[model samples]
Target: MKKLVVTLALSLLGATAFAQPLSPEAKTRTLETLQQAIARRAFVPGVDFSKLPDALEKRRAELDKAEDMRAFSNTVNQVLRDFGISHIRLFTPAAAQQRRTGQAIGFGLGMAPAPDGLAVSTLAPGSHAAGVGLAIGDVITEVEGKPAGNNPTSVDQDGRETSLITVKRKADGAQKHVMLLRKPYSTIRKPTLTWPAPGVARFTLPSFTNGYSQPEVDALFAEVAKAKAKALIVDLRNNGGGLVNNSAHLLSLLLPPGTPTGCSVTRQMVAEYKEKTGKESSDPIEVAKWKGPDRKTTLRKLPPYQGKVVVLINRGSASASEIVSSVLREERKSLVIGQPSAGAVLTSIFAPLPTGFEVQLPLSDYITPKGVRLEKNPIKPDVEVANALPAKEEASDPCVLAALKALTK
Candidate 1:
């Protein structure tokens, strides 16, 4: 059985190394290594790793025909899908580099699923997409002359290359064409804080990873307190999860003392506990220690805003994002607005395969303070505000508007 909940503390740590294509012998070794790692480290229990060799043997014929890294990885990924769990994804060499550096060459645009096509869900102010008149709720109709939705997340623009993007504006059913230039991923939009209203402070957290440091958060909250903000709206839409510790620290500023955010269980600690005690104990004292004493509690006292704390989330919110949102809503009494979250709350670890690609597998399970497992059950918002595209101004974002309305009432 898979572990039902992710822990309160998550590492979300991944490692990568360089390697060339694998030889026939190396391919077999890599498969065996991956199988062993999954059996030993994955949070999914009741999987007999001893039978892994036979499983590999049966797939060897197909795997042996893979001459390149992509082919091999695709084969392994298909096999892993049998586990029927999220967070078990493989990255090719190029993808591994992109993941490690968080770099990609494309126009700064964040996309999400739309009814007709990939919609422009996120457009950083002054970004290429924004400068070209791309607005939220615009359905991308074509990319590079091909129909959109082929590669919604990526545009293979070579150095300084330009790609033509066509979108249909939801406002008046008008078609618009825009040229997007390829740029470094670092040039993407970053988190920003603003005073949308006299007493309302909104923090748009675009991502949870990258250089999103604690000091940055400290400075933001300091400003919030200085402004005497009466209402705080944490907009976490499209913020995929990053480090669990970072989210925990963010919660520390808002949550009361002794609040239990959640708990984690790793395969390594489980094995160690069984080896030492000759038995497994649920919430083993030893495993608890690995999570550290500081991680178990929230002690920081934030400003006495005493005002409405509204969180804005959507399907793009996931992992650590979900963790922080759930804790604030469940324990801190904050109002959650917008759609449900992505429900990707598992803790994954990335390791290098023989082919130099990286594979991220769920290494730990987590549970919320209320014993809710966020594996597949996303956090439903108290106020379900659907997407209202083609807003004339940023302030008109449906989620933000909903938060402000909730705060005033």
Candidate 2:
């Protein structure tokens, strides 16, 4: 019975195993996981990721073969926004590109939650925002048609008290409309890989939601194999983490055979144990754990890379990303770099409820191979690097530079 709980607990820990492309059907199922969890009160404040994308897919096939993918994806964006979860998001290739270059539409204004309205923290001078005389202190009361408070976590520019923001310009104030954005900037998606340092070999696995998760990861490994790279670098910089099976395959790629990636409880075990005494244990019962330890590779029977590795992390690197980084740091002769990671490395699994939905919950806690747990207190980098975000434009990245320096030694 203990085994079952243990297994259930490990389900979340194993999410960093691998990344695979999600089929339309699989995508739908994944979102269902969130909805069901909300229904069962497993993952609170959860919203369904299934509805938007599925609807768009159908619209493309029927409504307009000439449909603009960008527009369709925008719809998906708005839908995700409705959920109001900080981590609940969707990113696409076009959006990703736009974000990187910062060139789409607005004069350059970024929003944060203020006491009452949205905060205009980042402003690109001489852009549309500045041209129209929108000052940083100006509060944003509304965006399009929705209430800003749909996401209760928003603030205005003046730092005043406001919610359900629907701010209109003075001219439009009596018109019941707010002309918040005179110049609209383009939106972009997130980066798939975070290259820590120039000389380091490994890369961070930020999320499996990227369509190329499986293929790109395989290619990365293959590249490492071909290069015969010795010093590796994996940077889970601000990665929120995603999915279960993908995490498993990711770990499988690097771990020695039978390394016990994680343990979890599944239905079959639940049924078997329940049958034994017709009673279900309330507490977590240990179940089967993933044991993928040492093994020989097909290529010249070579062993997995046992060379030095350094993982770069921060408070944002949560869930599965933390697990992989922590495991390698614990078992191998590796170094952790940067500030402390998010430290969410417990085993979590998504439970599929009967109502076509699933709920993801943490099952059990895992100690490092050395038996040290990485929960609230994340792994501290052996050599801490100062926090640099939106990455400052220098000749190169300092974190990568640090990794290179470490590897050279």
RMSD of each: 6.1, 13.4
lDDT of 2 by residue, 1-409 (tens): 0111111111011001011233455444444544444334222111343454454455444323223333333344455445443332333333333323334443344443455555443345444554555443344656545555423223222222222235433223332333434334432222243334443474645453333256667777667766766667776665555544565566666667556543333344444556765765422222222221212212213346555677777655666666667677765657777777666554544344332222334433444544454555577888888642223232255666777788888
TM-score of predicted model 1? 0.78
Best by lDDT: 1
> Local distance difference test, per candidate?
0.67, 0.46
lDDT of 1 at 141: 82
| Candidate 1 lDDT tens digits, 259-369 | 777766566766776787687655523454544332454565554245568988888788888988988887878988888987877777777766565667687766676
Stretches of candidate 1 above 4 Å error?
Answer: 1-29, 45-68, 123-133, 143-165, 177-183, 187-189, 267-295, 301-306, 388-392
Q: Candidate 2: global Cα-lDDT?
A: 0.46
lDDT of 1 at 125: 53
